[model samples]
Target: MNSVSTDLIIQSIYETLYMVSVSLLIGTLIGVPLGILLVITRANGIKPKRIFFTLLNGVINIVRSVPFIILLVAITPLTRLIAGQTYGSTAAIVPLVVYIAPFIARLVENSVLEVGPGIIELAKSLGASTFQTIRYFLMPEALGSLVLTMTTATIGLIGATAMAGTIGGGGIGSLAITYGYERFNTFVIILTVIILIIIVQIIQGIGNRLAKKLRHE
Candidate 1:
């Protein structure tokens, strides 16, 4: 109820947002291309390369299998090297991106795969190059699904940020643990949960509307 508590809550919100936004941006940059590659290199893909696809798929699977908390500790050295520290919001982004990128990549691959085979065959029949087919056909046809995929990935990242907070990665999760659980302040815990829920709802609403619009177009 005090000004100090309010300020801490506000700061935590900002920290969470910063970590989530940056991680999402970087993950998207890396994951989208990785996803496309996964699809295109599969056995039935336009340019199938079984060996390469198997290697890539294995790596993604291995990363996704590691629990986030363990991954946080496991990658501490790398995070410290990259962010100059292994704690706080910035350092948290390293692990967050590592964890989320493959997640997003899988989502993207699934989304792109949902595109009709007939459509892809049509593009190929017209002598469209791989790049041209992806750019003009696959991507356009899958835009709505891609938006939904990104939205799902973003929500997952938000949850990861909270877990990051448990390990000195400051955010509402840290706040909840320190004040709500540790100090036995139910109000703080409730408030933080409410804020996170509201954020997720807003994101879902926006993503749904955007995807609807794109689909209509």
Candidate 2:
């Protein structure tokens, strides 16, 4: 490959990172609160509201049911409105954030649910307020599991970033699709795959270590 190709690959990598990280940050901000509400609004939750819980839960489910690619196309107009266009890394983030926010909400709901009922009782016994109970007891107890869930979310974001490339989102995935598959350039495909593997490994390893540390604490 020429120096130009090498530079393109590096730039693609940066674009992928930019999309994934920005979406993850924004998604996490939206998702974590929704997850907390899902837990705290159920029938048995601290502040049960049957109608609200049911409605919120349904919306999350409906979004999750749609496939990511379809969601990408379906939200193109909104993407254009938010990102000011329907293509490229910045525009890609609108759909990516939309896709991952509810996904992270579900993951967070499951992770937070894994905290035992006993912990809730303990918090009550200590006279912790609703916010205090969640902040001090549930969150602390589920911290380790939440870390793992976020790790899974991160990896999922990476895959979605590649898919975003199909629509001119521009990343290693686009490079592979344009040069590797379309032009039958085996090297780009292999290189992209290897780079993705290395990225996933690094994320998983960090998650494991962080979870272990939280567990020890």
Candidate 3:
């Protein structure tokens, strides 16, 4: 490829990263807390409630049930409202955040559930309030899983960004679609695949290392 093509590819990667980071950040801001709430309010948990758990579970299921492509199209209006346009990396974040947050929430809920009930009871026996228990015990104990889940979510968002590219959101995937598939440019398609594979490998490696460190702690 020419230098100009290389430059464009690099720029597209950076734009893709920006979209993924913003979406993941926003998703985590909302999802982690909701996960905690789901854990704490379950019937067997500290602040047990049947109705609330059912409602939260239903909401999560509904969000998860929607396919990402459909959600991407459905949120175009909201994306345009927030981004002032819905056909670029910046515009892609709106649906990406909405798509990943509930999955992250469920990951967190599962991780928190893995914590021993005895640990929770011990926190209570020490007179720890609900907030304290979660803050001191649940979160700390689940930090490793949290890191892994975030890693997984980040990778998922990368795929979402590729789909966003089909709607004119510029990325390697968009380049592949417009130049590779349409024009039958096999080289661009192959190169884009290589770049994506490298990105996924790096993310997974970092996540595994972090999770291992957290486990040792």
- In candidate 1, the residue pairs with backbone N, CA or C atoms under 3 Å apart (3 or more residues apart, or in different chains) clash, namely none
Residues 31-80, model 2: lDDT tens digits: 99999999999999988999999999999999999988999999999998
Among the numbered candidates, top lDDT falls to 1
Give the Å error, residue 110, model 2: 0.8
| Top candidate (TM-score) | 1
State TM-scores per candidate.
Answer: 0.97, 0.96, 0.94
lDDT string for model 1 (1-217, tens) is 9222778899999998999999999999999999999999999999999999999999999999999989998999999899998868899999999999999999999999999999989998999999999999999998999999999999999889888986677888778878888888888888989999999999999999999999995
lDDT value, residue 157 of candidate 3: 88
List candidate 1 stretches off by more than 4 Å: 2-4
Between prediction 1 and prediction 3, the one with superior TM-score is 1
- Sort every candidate by TM-score, greatest first: 1, 2, 3
At residue 136, candidate 3 shows an lDDT of: 96
RMSD of each: 1.3, 1.4, 1.7
Evaluate model 3: give its lDDT: 0.88
- Residue ranges of candidate 2 with Cα displaced over 4 Å: 2-4
lDDT of 3 by residue, 34-102 (tens): 899899889888999889999999999998999998999998899999989988777888888989899
| Model 1: ten consecutive residues of lowest lDDT | 1-10
